[model samples]
Target: MNWALTNYERLLDLVWQHTWISGSAIALGFALALPVGWAAYAMKSSPHGAVRQLSGVTVSLSSVLYTIPSLPLFVIMPTILGLGWLNPINVLIALVIYAFAIMVRGVVDALNAVPPSVLDSAAACGFSRGQRAISVTLPLAGPVMLAALRVVSVSTVSLLSIGALVGVSNLGSLFTNGFNRNFPTEILTGVVLTVALALVFDLLLVAAGRLLMPWNSVVSAGGSA
Candidate 1:
């Protein structure tokens, strides 16, 4: 207890840094994923085989990106981009790439989950494809999309620890430092704090999702029937 209190500032600093690293990575991932998802959703309705092919190709590429080893990805980026150690930009880029496939898939799945009858109703009511997508499809798909985002958020938080391998001073750095020094107390502290932070963020996201898309609750309640 005494030791932990003394190290409180260090722990707080680690938490803040980790938050920044993970948050930036997830934000960039979402930015890239949203457009890819939108494109995939659009392709589903198009008669063009090329559009479907393109969506498949994009998903596959992103999956490949996710499979690349994280440490190697960090190491290779500095060499290729000439960004030295602990480059946040490179870290963010790699994290984004790592997360892209899940986000895209989430978007695609969410869009697909909308009922055919709802889509037909929209069409009958004179809703254009674009209007239906924005007003109806996306809204209906909100729960699934939020679920996907939750998964991505948790993933990003956990993986951000890997950034410490390349000298990024996040929570992972604290863990690494403690481990390298053979300090059990430090290691335990890092593990506990990181897990706590992850849980807090996860709960916050759940709350936000519920608030943003109350309709999801209705859908979920009906689905059990």
Candidate 2:
């Protein structure tokens, strides 16, 4: 307990490091998920059932990755990628994969929620399929997409704690070190700070969503009835 108060600098450093690790993972996840989501949305509108089915299968496979133990995934990745322990890149890769299914599913659902008549009207106005997607669909789906991003961000923040198992030091390392040394205060500090970070990020996402998708407020107001 005394050590915990005295190690304030170390605690602060760990928190900052964890935030970067979590942020990087979420950024990577979004970069990878966005195109896949758009592809899935396009496939959903296709006449062929097979294409839609394939999209579903891919999402399902990604979801399965989440069920696997984080430590095992961390251990396996270095061997698979030939990057040994303490590699943040492997942790990032695992987190991105873990995030993929949720993001893609959210995107598809958001796109589907867009009114079909709006899409048809866009086509009637001489917009091509790509144009309709870029303009009509994505614009209408902005709020839902933002919601998905929020979820992914919070999830990645919490999961980064597991990255410490493979020596990717962060807030998780604080908990790991504290626990091994039987330092209860340090362990509690890590837990509290991580939760606080998640809450702060969630609020930031909500604010950003409101700013980016003001129409969502209108939709929400109307739906309250």
Candidate 3:
């Protein structure tokens, strides 16, 4: 407890850095997943099936990217992006890669979950591919996407702790600092703070989804009755 109080300011700074990094990764992943997912789902009728093949390849590749251990990826990012070993950007990119790997599949699944009949209706009403995608398909897929966002957001917060291993930028540093000095309170503080961060993110995602998709809650309520 004394160690935690003594290091409170530093701990707060690390907490802010950790949150920022986690949020950036999730945001980047959400942005990139949209197009990748659309391509995977929409490229089915291309000549010689090249685009479809590309879709499969992308899913495979994202999975492989995520399978790489975080420590090695963090260490290797300097070579991959020519950034310094401790550059927060390296952690950012690696985390984004991980978030994307996890969310891209969810995006694909959500988009595909839009019913064929609803899509056909949109087409029959003279909606173009892009129009149907924007107005109908995506709206229908909102719940799934929100669920995916919730999952990825929590996962990103948890993983951001690993950035401390690089001893560069994050809450994980608290653990490292604690262990180095043999301070149990510092270690406990790190664990509690990270868990709090994840819980906060999860709640925010849930609230945002409900706020953005009131119809979903309504439908669920009606179904439950």
- Top model number, lDDT: 3
Could you tell me the TM-score of candidate 2? Answer: 0.89
Candidate 2 Cα outliers beyond 4 Å, as residue runs: 1-5, 219-225
Taking all chains together, each candidate's TM-score versus the true structure is 0.92, 0.89, 0.91
Residue 45 in model 2: lDDT = 56
lDDT of 2 by residue, 88-196 (tens): 8888788887777678777778887888898888899999978877777888988888788889988888888988878888888878888899988777888888999
Per-residue lDDT for 22-85 in model 1, tens only?
7877777878888888887787667989888887787777777778888898878777778877
Rank all candidate structures by their TM-score, best first, as comma-separated numbers: 1, 3, 2
- Estimate the Cα RMSD of every predicted model relative to the unseen true structure: 2.1, 2.4, 2.3
Candidate 1 vs candidate 3, lDDT winner: 3
**How high is the lDDT of residue 7 in model 2?**
85
Question: How many steric clashes between backbone atoms does each model show?
Answer: 0, 0, 0
Cα shift from native, residue 123, model 2 (Å): 2.5
What lDDT does the true structure give each of the candidates?
0.82, 0.82, 0.86
lDDT of 3 at 216: 83
